[model samples]
Target chain A: MPSPAGTPDADPVRASAGAPAADRAGGPAGEPLIEVRDLTRVYRRPRTSLTRPGEAVHALKGVSLTVHRGERFGIVGESGSGKSTLLRLLCALDRPTSGSVTFAGREVAGLPERSLRFLRRSLQIVFQDPMSSLDPRMRVRDLVAEPLVALGEPVGDRVAELLDAVGLPASAAERYPHQFSGGQRQRIAIARALAPRPEVLVADEPVSALDVSVRGQILNLLADLADELGLTLVFVSHDLAVVRHLCETVAVVHDGLIVETGPVDDVWEAPGHPYTRALLAAVPTLEGML
Target chain B: MLTVDGLGVRAGDLELVREVSFGIGPGERVGLIGESGSGKSLTALALMGLLPDGVTASGTARLGGRDLVGVPERRLKDLRGRTVSMVFQEPMTALNPLMRVGAQVAEVMTLHGVAAGRARERAAELLGRVRLPDPERIARSYPHQLSGGQRQRVMLAIALANEPDLLICDEPTTALDVTVQKQMLELIAEVAPALLFITHDLAVVASLCERVLVMYGGRVVESGPLREVFKHPRHRYTEGLLAASRLPPRGTRLATIPGSVPAAGRFPGGCVFRDRCAHATETCETAPELTAPELTAPDLTGPEPRGDGHAFACWHPRR
Candidate 1:
């Protein structure tokens, strides 16, 4: 792992920081990589169980969507709307009570553990906080290299190359997780996510923890990575501003169901759902000028 | 009315806020907008005597005619939850997780010697005032049980329990999602307490505040009515902050401030914003005072920068 440098934490802006319209135009659209039909996940409260009638949280209720190959699709919702649950289910980290998930048309929802392992690298997720996501004791290189190692791929010098790809200096891979700023740490997290060159990335609130100045930087980095790697990106966030700027299509989830799903432009200009409209009105818009 | 003059705070040898000053008339909403480490939250803490031990605050924060600086801790406590109250940024931390919502709120009135039954009654009223649904049911629920918005209303109920003359809300809506944040800010704006609101959400700041104070690196760079500040930010830092904000009419591309907020330990000897400023020059080597208005910064966008109430502080401010 590399030493986290430059900013307080996670200097997202320096990471090719955010996209210009030209940058968004880099990648062309492709076919459906992820297809879901009535996807649902029910989680029992932390320590509670199913036998005793626990406060069963219905995280996903009939979430259905088609994520085209190499497309940037954003899913937005309030905290409890099951966005996180859907991510976990798509990554095959949790089982859905009743739903169909066909990744690359392979019917992955009920795939056995052995089959799921092979599919894991194809669908990766970048979480909110790098501090919690990356192990503290591990060096930056090892953190990124872990995925490659797990996949039985020879890391060799690619760890240092990955660090530079995410805009961190090659020297960063040697430092512990705490040594980096928040933005730097998240970049490292991104490098680790890209280690296996996944076909799709479920980035859940990746930039929400970053400051506005750095947030733009992180948003741009994702756009560049998606274009360069030709990966389908499922960007999940509660911030409509982020969704509007980063994604081509959006799925607005509310109360465990998707209330509004459409292309970003139409939804932003003429939102049909009251919840989507409210979400739009709620975000503080920037004034005209640079 | 609330007025702060020459307010300076220090943690050891590092001066966090220097020569800060601002005022809010009764029922007027003012926003102190800045990013992390800007001392905006710390200023609110100083006004409420909530500064941690070892931190020294010097300056006069007068509320309604009483001098808050140098006021003894005991009197400050008495004044707190009664004379002046605050709604913190994180409702979860501000509230006790184990305690019932009613008890946390009722404590304010009870401390002022209001009877237990009456305090409980008043707690529900406060909750209802904040537009909380089923005040009675909400009163019984614990902090952990309430949603983020509900938890914030509970915090507001407690802050308004004694009906203080001033309410300082620190980034009150940061933790909330876009939808929830809008509702919470609207609820707070409608209540219209004499506010000294602090936030990084420039759009929310523009929407809610009447007067604006733009801080950078623990110093007041600009202060004025919202219309004036937003339209024509005279300070280079203010310009960067406004440009950098994800608010309406913003540049299509993400506008950046070149560098990050300078850390406190390495306080710059000159203008606080110089290291990261696009307009820095040899003159910045000598610290610039929060200067009086001279050059009228034409609104970079056009027509809205000035309605005669705006002001700025800078030696080399951008257009």
Candidate 2:
């Protein structure tokens, strides 16, 4: 197996020494590609006639992490664990209440919309539901070309290549999104995400909506694409098996906080936190039974 | 006890579930495993006589002495909650948002002629049995007030409120996280007498059921002891499904079944799985009935026959 160059251990402190000198804000080896420090997001419920005072809900609390270039990082958590909130913050889709998210050596949190063009080109997201994400009325060709068209980049034959890369035929470009199955639609969504040739790809529960038989194919495709493109992939899911299969490092989130972070194998073999242990125990496996 | 034999469900000329057969003994846990569009849910709806209008069912489905197929609506309505209860995938959708959890549980008993006052008390007890904390508070709360895990427990509590002979849970834990799912599975196992657990997850089926029936293209492709089928899957589709479930070692290509499940009514005339089967030959053109092929012990050169049981509908089965 060809591991990424300069893969770090769970301990970021130890990784400081070998980290490449910061050449461009987010530099090469040694320096992290993405750094999040003390990130927190709190949502306040609106006061209603029945209730005088509104309550504050902490969606995320003091979360800190670093994603090295070309590394597959995974965030695993159940509903209400703030995994989704964290992803939104990382992608700059939503700003945090406090703390900082530095991407490519530039702060992303609270960044102005006009200045976000660079971040937009660098980071791309593939949502959970392909059916909802892809425009039903749009042709596959136009859907794949939308990112490039928005960025003012040329869309000559790029859509065709992307479809081929994701294993979809070139002819699929002419068809509407509704004509394809769930897995095929996801492939189209993936192809669209890759059209911009982004450096970082963030996928939230990409395969959870797919059938078991086709889930493997999509996972393999994502892993292969990330490696082939040397893209820094940040994948968020509740399924530990999928994370273990595709990720080198994993962070387990619980109750709006990261409970544990470590190498995928290490965490799976001996989880450090109580929540991690409980989550692992819940996964049904055929190891002994089969 | 439930015995479903040669049960087929169809709409006009289209067959949704064809020649399906299975038996769930008293207190037994049987699983129906299949991927999307495999007719697993349709078969469950057929068992409950819940197939939508315009669709008709054939063959015999005997639940104790009652016939579920083509039964009168009035009789089926009485037997539904009192005899066989079902827990669905989405708890929130399955429950009434306007109704309190406690009242919903109590309603099942009250409809069966239990005293109104006694039904409320029993509902609380059932909630407690399903491990929902603060049964009294939960009973008063609406479905939206509780968490996903709590709502699922309430669904289980309602399903078991009548102490039905059989319980059919269709992907009950699929919507839940791993930890909550484990708890729900344990509770379901503890409370239900006989369970017909339906899911696309093979590992979950292996964990909960001793016997399993593998469905594909609206047909029961394989049926037998869970361990026996898992160890040596005879049908090509079952083998593909099992192989797909397990992730290969890191950085390796996963073994995937090439094509997706055929759309409804578009299944090939002969072998429904022939399109995806690597070993399919001309012989597969003729439809094959469920049969148990002889297995030879590996140690001996001569064929050592195995006992009869486990069956697969395939022309070329792996022995």
Compared with the true structure, all predictions reach lDDT values of 0.78, 0.85
Q: Candidate 1 residues A1-290, lDDT tens each?
A: 01111102212232122121122233335766787777877876765655576576766767787778877888987776677788777888778999888888888886778888657778888999888999998999899999999988999988988888788899998899888767788899999999988898889999878766767667767877877888788999987777887887887776667767777777788876666776776666655211
lDDT of model 2, residue A69:
86
State how far residue A38 of model 2 sits from its true place (Å): 0.9
Candidate 1 chain A, run of 10 with poorest lDDT: A1-10
TM-scores for every candidate against the unseen true structure:
0.88, 0.92
Each prediction's RMSD over C-alphas, in Å, is 8.4, 6.3
Q: List candidate 1 stretches off by more than 4 Å.
A: A1-29, A44-52, A287-290, B247-252, B293-309
What lDDT tens digits, residue by residue, belong to model 1 across residues B1-319? Answer: 6778889999998899988877777888888888888899889889989899999899898888888887899888888878788988899998988889998899889999999999999888989998887899989999888888788888888888887888889988888766677678878888756888998877788878777888888888887767767876788887777666652321246666765565676657788888888788899988887655433445433222222245666789767
How many angstroms is residue B46 displaced in model 1 relative to the true structure, after the best TM-score fit?
A: 1.1
Q: TM-score: which candidate is best? A: 2
Model 1 error, position A183 (Å): 2.2
Give Cα distance to truth, residue A10, candidate 2, Å: 18
